[model samples]
Target: MLASVGEIVVVRDGSGPEILLVHGGAGPRTTWGALAPLADRWTLAYVHRRGYPPSPPPQQRQDFEVDARDLAPLLAGRPHVVAHSYGVLGTLIAAAAAPGSVRSLTLIEPPLNYLVPDDPEVARLERIGDAALTHGMDMDPAELREFLRVAGAPIGDGPLPAGVVAGVRRAHGGRPTSEARPQLEAIRDVGVPVLVASGDHSAALERICDSLADALGGKRSVHPGAGHFVAAAPGFAEQLETFLHKSVR
Candidate 1:
């Protein structure tokens, strides 16, 4: 069923405990398709984030502050929150604002370069991401390819498909990751169970995840092979299930 909360379209599925699945730049299916089997044991509320179809486009550039506003209402009833990529910025903000309102948090490969500001490698990736999101369709082929690689876009990539092009267009002018500074202390202070996971493909990303894990006093896991899309990597679903079970309050 579709539920409209703060203009966000949530597609609910399965039954059992609830998990609010927030998609990032690539949209919901690409972000969480690998977790489909988990719906058998848990209710999954798939959120179509702003700028994606079904959900209205953002008023201006896609900003996490706007996303936090959209997501705040969905946190009601304390559903376990699982957000990927760009979506994690807003999730972290909302969770920090009202820590007790979330059952748990599982963040996968969030581009939280601010978490490791001193890491030049992380800074390099952040610059590339910012340029890609800001320029979007205007990006040159080489630059676009690099962005797709970092984003784990599933494409064999001869010529870009219309759908992929559209996705890129939607991401145009998105707020940069360098601007994301979620209140890690607030989440930590409230003792929210948090899991920060990343693919072992990029040492820079793993560094950011490691730093975020330390800041939030959370567990960290590396599920390699999927690059930025760690959710699709082998053993990810099982590990996520176990983490969710252990996080139950």
Candidate 2:
């Protein structure tokens, strides 16, 4: 069913315990479509973050702080929260605020580079992201492509889709991921079982994920082959299901 969690639009389907699925720059379907089949066993709440259609856009740009405010009220049920890419920033903030309300937290390739800020590769990735968001569509084609590549956006070699372009535009001038300093200690103290997964496609991302896992005292898994779309990687559903099964509240 379609419902509103505060101002955010949410599509909830299936049965059993809820698993909130938060997408990053990509839409819900792009991020979680591969896991739709899991609805047979678990309810999936696909959050339509601000700047996405059906959900109202943010008052400013696509800032994670706005997302955190939007997501805080939705955590009442202690759902297993799964967030990807940029969405992870806000989700982390929300979860940290009410750590006991989260059953388990799974993060996919979030650009929380501050955890490993000294790494040259992480710095490179951060620079590319800043450039892309700063320039948006005005960025040089090659630079934009490089940004998209690091972001795991599946633009391929074809002309950019209108939806994709719009998503990029919405991201223009958004808060940089490095600026997100979620209360990791607060979350860790609550003893939430956190799982940080990476695609193993980028060394920089892997390094960041490693630090995140360590800081959160969470298990880290690398699901190769899907690049940035780690949720769609082969055998990922099974692994996630296993984790969820063990994590159920």
Best by lDDT: 2
Superposition error at 8 for model 2 (Å): 0.7
lDDT of 1 by residue, 6-68 (tens): 777999989999999998888888889999999899999999988777888888889999999
TM-score of each: 0.95, 0.96
Which stretches of model 2 miss by more than 4 angstroms?
156-161
Candidate 2: C-alpha lDDT: 0.89
CA shift at 128, candidate 1, in angstroms?
A: 0.8
Check candidate 2 and list the clashing pairs.
Answer: none
Q: Which lDDT tens digits does candidate 2 get at residues 146-167?
A: 8788777668788887867877
Off by over 4 Å in 1: 155-157
lDDT, model 2, position 121: 87
RMSD of each: 1.4, 1.4
